[model samples]
Target: MNEDLTHLTREELIAEVVKLRKGIRAHRDSTMHELCWHHPQLWNLLPEKTIPEIAVPAWPQFIRGCLRYRESLDTQLPDAPRVKKEFNDPDSPSNI
Candidate 1:
């Protein structure tokens, strides 16, 4: 019987996961780095922290999001007419 897995099935994979998690908990002191990997505080955009340690590029990501939004804009509305509006300035009509 494998000790790591709570259930009896697939013991080897579970052991690997448990080992990895234990290592992270025991030796990793960089929780903020992990958090910042997925969540940018925006304060890190400054000169001291212009680029994050991770390979993610901010501008390219922003552009990709814009492109996706633009593509979704052209999509036809439903019979009830689902209106797409720019919430940034609610008063103005949305192009999408």
Candidate 2:
């Protein structure tokens, strides 16, 4: 699959995200669970607010693969440090 992520317009980006969500759902159905389960990190690839819907049905192996792909992205964000921190401050949005 191609991973070229050009700057998409708002509508196009939303459409892309919707399509990806569909694909993730479909993938959850088509493959065995282990394909996504091995790596616990895959859950982090998705938006924190909406991840459960997309990930709940997916196999652990597939989730692991998804996480591997997410981490392997060309410009992915850094993983958080060992300690967990709250991010409810208005000034610092979670996206950053």
Candidate 3:
């Protein structure tokens, strides 16, 4: 699915840029839960069909990684507004 950029008209190039920007913005705006899910659709933006093998950590390590990610946000966006937890129930499958 390689696109020949050489053949694209000025308008076509602009349209492609706009399309890619929208996709990038959507990924940028994703929340915590969305971040944990696989994003094949985002990968589809490229011209490849191959999927790389993913390595998932064990539960304890995974939770620790999540905690570190939150800690990083504190450092990176210290003054950012906070959102109330949407998945706080301990027994819930979607708890974050």
Better of 1 and 2 by TM-score: 2
Q: Candidate 3 local accuracy as lDDT? A: 0.77
Worst 10 residues of 3 by lDDT: 87-96
Q: How does each model score on lDDT?
A: 0.49, 0.51, 0.77
In TM-score terms, candidate 3 sits at 0.70
The model with the greater lDDT, 1 or 3, is 3
Q: Using Cα atoms with residue i matched to residue i, what is each candidate's TM-score against the true structure?
A: 0.22, 0.27, 0.70
Q: Tens digits of per-residue lDDT for model 2 on 4-88?
A: 3466678877887887777677556532223334433445444343434343535887669777775664345355322222334
Pitting candidate 2 against candidate 3, the one with the higher TM-score is: 3
lDDT of 2 at 36: 33
Per-candidate alpha-carbon RMSD to the true structure: 13.8, 14.4, 4.5
Q: Report the lDDT tens digits of candidate 3 across residue range 1-96.
A: 446677889998898788888888889898755766677777767656778788999999999998998889899989866755556555545432
Q: Where does candidate 3 stray beyond 4 Å?
A: 1-3, 88-96
Measured by TM-score, the strongest candidate is: 3
